[model samples]
Target: MDWHTLGSTPFLPPLYWRAALKRKITGSTLPEQGLRCRVRINPNDVAAYRKVCGFADSPILPATYPHILAFGLQMQLLTAKDFPFPLLGLVHLSNRIRIHRPLGGVSELTIGVQACNLQPHSKGATFDLLTTAEDSLGLLWEAESRMLCRGVKLEGEALDNPLPTPTQVSELTRWKAPADIGRRYARVSGDYNPIHLSALTAKLFGFPQAIAHGLWNKAHTLAALGEHLPAANIELHVEFNKPVRLPSEVTLYCSAPGSSGELLLKGTGDLQHMVGKWQPIA
Candidate 1:
């Protein structure tokens, strides 16, 4: 397949100030040029991501690191010319990541992201963004991220994407996420979306207070899984049910493995703010 260097997303008035207008996202346009970029792995940043996610550094890149690296390009594609939905009101419904193999520190990568498959949800329209990263060898990693554009419900609205409910589950440890967690994570992952910065800045985006980055929560959950990971051929998935406002304590839990297992990052209440799982990608 042909690939090109990633470029700045085509800008329009809608993306510049999505928050200012409180506009309901309408339309369903897809990008003509999918997001593609060549990225050399930054050893320092990889180490930083590991540290933030509470992992001991190694030459092997964490499974979630590629997704972290590809996030910007994904956003650009979502906001590209004539994008159907506004960026501000969209909710990340879930993510499925497959780690085919480990990429060492010295690997040079080609990353591609494309928005695909918009479907209907009771509350809105949901779409999938597929992101993939590879080197000369073959496919290194890939992810399917589903996002919800609230208020743009298509015909035959489907069930809301809820957190996973597994029959056999266990409660893991709890951690108090500091108010500055978002910025702290941004330093590691380079995802500085303003809604995560602080209360005042987040207010501009309609969040009462700053919220934790969904990807950060995924990495944290994976880190907590520790040695439980399958020896090889791992695929991890997570659903973001609700936002975890900053300065909060949340619990982590997981379900018994039948096919894919479930991991829950829960606030004080029973609500699993985020749900995730991992299995061998057969």
Candidate 2:
């Protein structure tokens, strides 16, 4: 918890771009943590984000959009020269988001992002980056993004997969996501990671071609599951396993509505793409 301050830094050369350029330019030692940043939401950007994420225009802000608002703050921590671990080759294991209230009424927010809780897995080392957004009303939203770092396995107990295996899943919806979906999401979310935008750029980082943003997968999945979500207080969590290749078709799946208020989405070859649970705040 070094608690580095991010004062008025521009959010250009996003996380992916910086990582691709600095994969081999890191220090032999570890980096510090607790980096923070803030921003005022622009009305125009919010509108564009809503369009890209399929959130209808309303006075109220979509629950997931706050993650997009925190993107710049996230990039700040990810690209910090002192930050440990190159952004390249880092796998997004899972994402958990909690919104205490709808933010459509709020116009400004203060974002704080911190990287903490580094633990080792059988396959690799894993960590969680926690980001919180606070407004005049107090902390309105918070999210925990989990990442896996391969080649950094440590001696410890094997990590148990919290997700249930999908057995009898039925397709809920299928659609072809265009090659440009990544770029579109990048523009709206300010996550212009090269791997998600271009094949040539992606090849630099070992991907055969460009891939969709994991957050985009979560957003679209949420849009599909909108009818089932509760109003106001909600928490959504998804673990990403495989990359959804560019210009590929996607089919969402589910088992049955359990008492847990969960909805599942699986990938081909039975790869676990995402498992989301939505519950109302009591």
Candidate 3:
């Protein structure tokens, strides 16, 4: 890969606009390059993230928070002219995160992002956006986010969906997801995808109404299970099954944290939005 290290994160809004233009240009293929940058955690930003995602106050950064640091790099890569897909329509299918140690005392982290694992999906093609974060000490966190570029077909067998259906779950908690949740999260996370911003913008992308950001729901679920999370060496995996429309009431359900670790978020009419679990890495 053509790797380039940057002194600061790239701005996302322009890149997003670039993506819109690139979508109209045909024959673009995934690039063979990656981006790396150094980032310092902001305590105030972490606090705001905690309040939005429902995490309890802690000096330690929540496991899901690091994705925010990696997002700009992700956008830069996806919006490049050589990237194969448009950022606006690609669906976030699954996210897998691994935390190797506590980040409470860490001040700066080196973050890297690359796209890989291009394969076929029944609906279209799928690929992985891999991100890593390391401190002066060593690698501390990483994640693999799978995205589906719908309606694209390729010359390979499609992989079966690996997310298992939930069974025998007990209600854990309910949340009223406000219509403005997308705007709130976008202000903090920098993922201003139109589908998640407002109903007017969402309809342009075929979504009947504004949809909540999948990572927001993922973070909220992790926060609910915060008491059971291990100090370090843990992995959290989640698959988005459906979108949670705006101004909706959703319920979190799981068999039990210690027993099964399986958790899911469902909206009105019992629409399953996400299924996930967290486990201590041995």
Candidate 4:
């Protein structure tokens, strides 16, 4: 994973400029290299990280931090002599994850990541990458993340594009999310973002209530996938279409494969509100 060589492409063109404009509006970008890493999900670590993230108690690990292990491994990969790229300039444009299981205590986990296609943009270049994580028993807990990167521009105002209408994929699951889900997630993962806590905070952000953190949904989704899919060496891709409201009855709609195979998980609501997609990492 020579990030430097990977990102050394020169010359910006009109198409890239157009793509950059579109990304500015959509908040999308590509990351450098994606690779796997390992982490020990210790209960103590979860409790410590939770307090640091500002939760009153240890919430469940936010669904997203497992990918952080991927990122941590990525950093190590970048340090290899064969590795390329400067770490300072990269920025996280967007992130999406689907959890297949709930992380209860400390366990050894493996993460998989890969750099994807790069599209040019006015700011610089937009690169995409994928990441996945699994446990020792060969159970996949979660998968999928997309990231973007670009060079700084002089004008500072990158071009923006109109919002594309979201396509309705499928209805979300009908499982009832626990009332303490948000607090639990906040505690486990050290993310104290008020939007996942107080009603007033969510109201300020235009949410109906203090919605469940995205990572919580990811964790639960991973737990579910692990039940049916072959845990070892699995890959997945997911998109966040809509927010899951607190204490809501959500039904998970998943497309999974047989043991030693591939699968897709697309979720929707009873009212047919499309949530997102979960497929093997390409």
State which candidate has the highest TM-score. 3
Minimum summed lDDT over a 10-residue window in model 1 is located at: 9-18
Name the TM-score of candidate 3: 0.95
Where does candidate 1 clash, by residue pair? 29-84
* C-alpha RMSD for every candidate: 3.5, 3.0, 1.7, 11.4
TM-scores of the candidates are 0.86, 0.86, 0.95, 0.47
Task: After superposing candidate 1 on the true structure, give the runs of residues whose Cα lies further than 4 Å from its correct spot.
Answer: 1-4, 7-26, 159-163, 255-260
Provide the overall lDDT of each model, using Cα atoms, as 2-decimal numbers.
Answer: 0.75, 0.73, 0.86, 0.47
Q: Which candidate is the best by lDDT?
A: 3
lDDT against true structure, model 2: 0.73
Candidate 4 residue lDDT tens string, 46-65:
55544333323423454445
Give the better candidate number (1 or 4) by TM-score: 1
Runs in model 2 deviating more than 4 A are 2-9, 14-18, 24-32, 153-155, 166-171, 254-260, 267-272, 280-282
Better of 2 and 4 by TM-score: 2
Q: What is the clash count for each candidate, in the order shown?
A: 1, 2, 0, 42
Write one digit per residue (lDDT tens) for candidate 1, span 54-102.
Answer: 7666666777888877866766666554577767667877888888776
- Off-target runs (Cα >4 Å) in candidate 4 are 1-40, 43-65, 68-144, 147-173, 256-282
lDDT of 2 by residue, 1-282 (tens): 576666764556655567667664343234566665667778898888777766667787766777777777677677778876777677888898888877667877877788777787776678888888888888888889998777664666757577664556577776666899889998898776778998988998799999889888888877666555654577777777678888877778764544236656655666565676666544
